[model samples]
Target: MKTFLNKVLVAYFAMTAGLILLNEPGYAYLWAGQGGTDVYIVHSGKDKEEKSALKKALGGDFKVKFYNVDLLALADYSGKQKAIIKLEKARIVIFIKDAPHELLEGSTLNTKVIIFNSGKDALKSKVKTFYLVDKTIAPPGGNTVRASSGSELNKAEAIRNADAVVVDGALDIYKAAALVVAALL
Candidate 1:
């Protein structure tokens, strides 16, 4: 019995150590990138196009990272906490469509947050909030600007409340990327 217990303990310790090593921030940095991420994107993992567009739009100027988290997974407290930790580390956090508003719960004041197709329940935070709207949807009753193309987005000033900045859905991904890049600037 003593020998069996010792073997079980050794296996448990090995598993724990492996898990710790896999989750270490240094390990992630080494694999993902060498420096801190400038933009951290959390999305539903359904749209590959959106991810590619954002990356292209950001270009080589910024170090961006993407997290493909399932909305249902975030329902768990531990899962939500882990997502929040990553969110807080970013200079800017962009929540693509279907990403839960709950992930914004614990973000720091310095972090800038942008949400595309944000739901009405989006919690107000100390961090700067920018909401991207689809041109087809009605404006959510605040400062809004109509930007159909990248050039239009570049010309338009920040919406007074930044509550809504409309982007044409009919446009190509590059146009959408331009709008997002404009928001990030």
Candidate 2:
């Protein structure tokens, strides 16, 4: 009985230690690429069309990749640790759905955090949330463009031309990506 109890205690401690280790940072190698800017998008994999649009929006300047961070095995974790591990290599981290609040936990992470909002309640936190809208399906009056809308490529120049007028709630992936690039630039 004594030996069994000792083994159980050891196992418990080991598991605890492992969990602690999982929370530490430095996991950039996961986003391996040939050498362009790396952008990581943490999505739920349900929005196939939106995902494709986002990729199309990315110019040659970025190596865009999508990751479904909410796996059953890692369900217990807030996913902030996973974000931290790959934070170093990622130029920007975009949250399509299920934004990991853990990323904003403790000290601020060096990578940028973008939360894509599609009529969902915004996070109470002050972090940037890009409003998104589906232009083809929505009722009239609201501004939303189709995913393949051939808007001008010069979002930054347009933004500048607007005299600093900030546009909110992007219509499609192209516009969203343009907004992100503008912010980064």
TM-score of each: 0.63, 0.48
Off by over 4 Å in 2: 1-37, 72-79, 98-108, 119-173, 182-185
lDDT of each: 0.64, 0.50
Residues 35-143 of candidate 1 have per-residue lDDT tens digits of: 6677877776675777777778777877788887676464666776667676667777777765555554544445777666654435333666666657655644666
lDDT of 1 at 144: 66
lDDT string, candidate 2, 27-112, tens digits: 34433444645777666656566666677777656777777644533555655555555654566666564333333334244555
Clashes of 1: 0
lDDT of 1 at 5: 100
Q: What's model 1's lDDT at 11?
A: 100
Which residue pairs of candidate 2 clash? 27-85
Q: Evaluate model 2: give its TM-score.
A: 0.48
Poorest 10 consecutive residues of model 2 by lDDT? Answer: 159-168
lDDT of 2: 0.50
